[model samples]
Target: MNKKLQFLVLGVVLILAILFFSVKWAFRPASKSVEKEKADFTMEASALAGEFEIDEQKANVMYLDKVIQVKGIIDNISDEKTVISVTLKDPESLSGVICSFDKSSLTITQLTPGEKITVKGICTGYLLDVVLSKCALVE
Candidate 1:
C-alpha cells in the first residue's frame, strides 16, 4: 500500500493492541492467594482502628486493599448463620477492627468473644469499624 495508507493502518493497529492488553491486564484475576500473601503491616487491632479514626485518608493510603495482621481480643461474632463477623475490641465500641471470614471457613465456628487472637486479612477501610476481608486465624 502507499506510505500514508500503511501508516494509518499501523497507527490504528497499535492503538487497538494497547487497548486490548490494558483491558486484559485490568481484568486479570489476582494471582496471590489471600492466605498465602504476606501482611504489609502488623499491629494491635485497637491501634489499627485508632489510625483509621484519627486520619482516615492517611490510613487508607497505608492499609486499604493491603494485607494486615492484627492481634486483639474478640469482641463479638455476629449471630448470622451464613457469615462470620469477628469484632475486635470492646463489644460496645463503635470503632474497632471487624474481620470477616467466608462462611465456608471452619475457623470462624471455633472463635469466641473475649478470646485473644491474631488474624490476617485485607484491610477494606473504615466506616464505623475498620473492615477486613478474607481473614484467616493466625494463631
Candidate 2:
C-alpha cells in the first residue's frame, strides 16, 4: 500500500514538472539576433523614383516589399525629434526616395542637404515619392 502511494505521487510530480517546463519554453520571447537580409536590388534614388513615375504598377511589381540600396544626394530630412525620415535628390526635387530608418539604426546625425549617401531599405511603394522603410545607412 505504501509503494502504491509513492508511485502515484511520483507520477503527479513528473506531470507537473513537464507542464512547467513546456509552458516556460512556449512563452519565451523571440530572439532579436537575426540580421537583416542583403539588399535584393540596387539603384540610384532618382532612378527608382523615375521608374515609379513611368509606371506605378510595373514598379510595384519590380520593387515592392524588396530590399533596395539607393544612392543620391540628400534632399530633405524630417525635423522631428526622432529624425527617422530622409529624402534623396530628384530633378524636380519633389519626387525621390523617401526613407524611414528603423529604430535599431537611428544613430545618424550631422546629415546636411546635398550630402551624398547610400541607404538600404525595404520598398513599401510610392505616393508622391518612392517610400522605403526599415532603412539603414550604407557606408
Candidate 3:
C-alpha cells in the first residue's frame, strides 16, 4: 500500500481500538457487581456524604457499583417505575447518593416520606450526583 494509505489504516485501527475499549470499560459492571457474590454491606446515607465520604479516593469502588444493602430513612421516592431515588437525611443532605432502582427487582407497598428502609443495589458512581446500580428495595 502507499505510505498515505498505510498511515490512514493505522489511524483507523487506533481509533477503533480506543472506541471498543472505552465502551467495554464503561459498561463493564464494577468489580463489586461480579466478585461480591452477595451484596450485603449496609450504610446509612448520613455517613456517605458526611463523615463516610472522602471525595478523594473512596468514590468509585466496586462496593459502590456492587449490589449491597443500605439502611436509610426514606427521604424521597422519586420514580414509580424501575428507578427510585432515595437520599440521606438531616446532616447528610440529599446530595449523597441518588440511587436508581431496577423496577423489576422489588416493590415497596409502604414506602413513606420518613420511614427507614433497607435497599440493595450496586454503587455505580460518585459525581455531583452519586448513584448506585440496578437497585432493589429490601423488604
Candidate 4:
C-alpha cells in the first residue's frame, strides 16, 4: 500500500518473472531434423555373403546403383581419418556390401573391427571405388 511496500512487491514479482523465463528458455527442445522418405536397403545374412564372395567389381555393381542401408560391423579402419570403410556380409565373410563414414559423426572416439553397426547411404555406382551417399551411423 505504501511506496516502500509497493516497491518491494514489484521487485519480487520482477525477479520471479525473470527466473521463470530463464528456466523455460534453457529447457526448450532443440530443432528437429527434416524427416526423409522411407527407403530401405536390406539383405539376408546368407544372400549378402553370397554377393560379396563372388568378385570385387561384380559385387560393387549390384549395390552401387541405389541408396543402400547396410547393417554390419566395422571391419577395417583407416588411421588418417576416423573413417571406417564398412561392409555388409554374412557368416562366410564374402559379400562386400560396403559403406563408409567420417569420425566426427560418431559419439565414440574410434570404431574397430567386429563392432557391429548399421549404416544408411546412397550407393553411388563405383568410380574406381564405391561412392556412398550421406553415410550415417545407424548403430
Candidate 5:
C-alpha cells in the first residue's frame, strides 16, 4: 500500500477501536448494590449533615464519593419516576441528609415521615443538604 493509503487505514482502525471500547464501557453492567457493599463510614444522618455544615471542604475530602451508612428519622419522602428521594433529618434542624434510591429497588409505600430508617449509599457531596446517591435501605 502507498504511504498515504497506509496512514488512512491506520487512522480508521484506531477510530474503530476507540469507538468499540467506548461503547463497551458505557453499557457495562452496574456496580454492586450499596446494600451488599460495606460502608466506609457509618453514622447518624444528623451527624453527617453536621460534619458538612461545620466544614464542607473537610467533609468533602472525607466523605465525597465514599460509601456511607446513615441512620435517621425520615423527614420527607418524595417518589419520582426513576428515583425516590428520602430526606433524613432531626425535626428541629434546617439541614438534612438526602438519600436517593432507585425506585425499582425500594418500595416506599411502607416508609413514612418520623419513622427511623438506616440507609447505605455513596456520598455525592453537600449542597444545603448532604446528598447520598444510589442508596439502599439497610434492613
Candidate 6:
C-alpha cells in the first residue's frame, strides 16, 4: 500500500480505538450500594467527628474514602430534592458526622431526630463536620 494510505488508515484506527474506550467507560455500570459493601471501620459518630476535630490530616489518612459504620443519635435530618442528609452527633456538641443518602434509596419517613441509629457510608472528608456519602441505615 502507498505510505499516505497507510498513515491515513493508522490515524483512523487510533481514533476509532479512542472512541470505543470512551463510550465503554461512559456507560460502565454503577458501583454496588454502600449497604452491600463491608465497612472498613466502625465506631460511634461522636468519636468519628472527634478524630477529624483532633487532627484533620491524620483523620483523613485513616478514614477518608473508607467505608465506615457509625452509631449515634440523630441530630438533624434534611430531605433535599434528590438527597437526604442525616446529621449524627452528641446533644451537647456542635460538630457532627453528616451522612448523605440517595432519596430513593432510603425511607426517611421512619428516621427522626434524637433517635439512635447506625449508618454505613464512605467518609468523604471534614469541613466543620465529618462528611459521609452514599450512606444507608444499618438495621
lDDT of 4 by residue, 6-107 (tens): 999999999999999999999987422111423356644335445544564686767655556556655555443555555544445544445555544543
State which candidate, 2 or 6, has the greater lDDT.
6
Candidate 1 weakest ten by summed lDDT: 29-38
Against the unseen true structure, what C-alpha lDDT does each candidate score? 0.85, 0.82, 0.61, 0.56, 0.92, 0.91
* Least accurate 10 contiguous residues by lDDT in model 3: 30-39
- Per-model TM values vs. the true structure: 0.72, 0.70, 0.57, 0.47, 0.79, 0.79
Separate clash counts for every candidate: 0, 0, 6, 4, 0, 0
Tens digits of per-residue lDDT for model 3, 38-138: 66566766565443355626544535545666677766667655455666354446456565655544444547777776666666666664566666666
Q: CA shift at 78, candidate 4, in angstroms?
A: 1.8
**lDDT for model 5:** 0.92
Residue pairs clashing, model 3: 64-123, 65-122, 65-123, 66-122, 82-103, 122-133
lDDT of 1 by residue, 1-139 (tens): 6999999999999999999999999999754226778999999999999889899999999998999999999988885666588899855445999888867653556888889999899999899999998888888
Model 3: lDDT to the true structure:
0.61
Question: How much does each candidate deviate from the true structure in C-alpha RMSD?
Answer: 5.2, 5.8, 8.7, 10.8, 5.3, 4.9
Q: What are the runs in model 1 whose C-alpha is more than 4 Å off?
A: 1-33, 79-81, 91-94
Better of 1 and 5 by TM-score: 5
Model 3, position 68: C-alpha lDDT score: 60
The order of the candidates by lDDT, greatest first, is 5, 6, 1, 2, 3, 4
Cα lDDT, model 3, residue 64: 50
Choose 4 or 6, whichever is better by lDDT: 6
Q: Which candidate achieves the best lDDT against the true structure?
A: 5
Model 2, runs deviating above 4 Å: 1-35, 81-83, 91-94
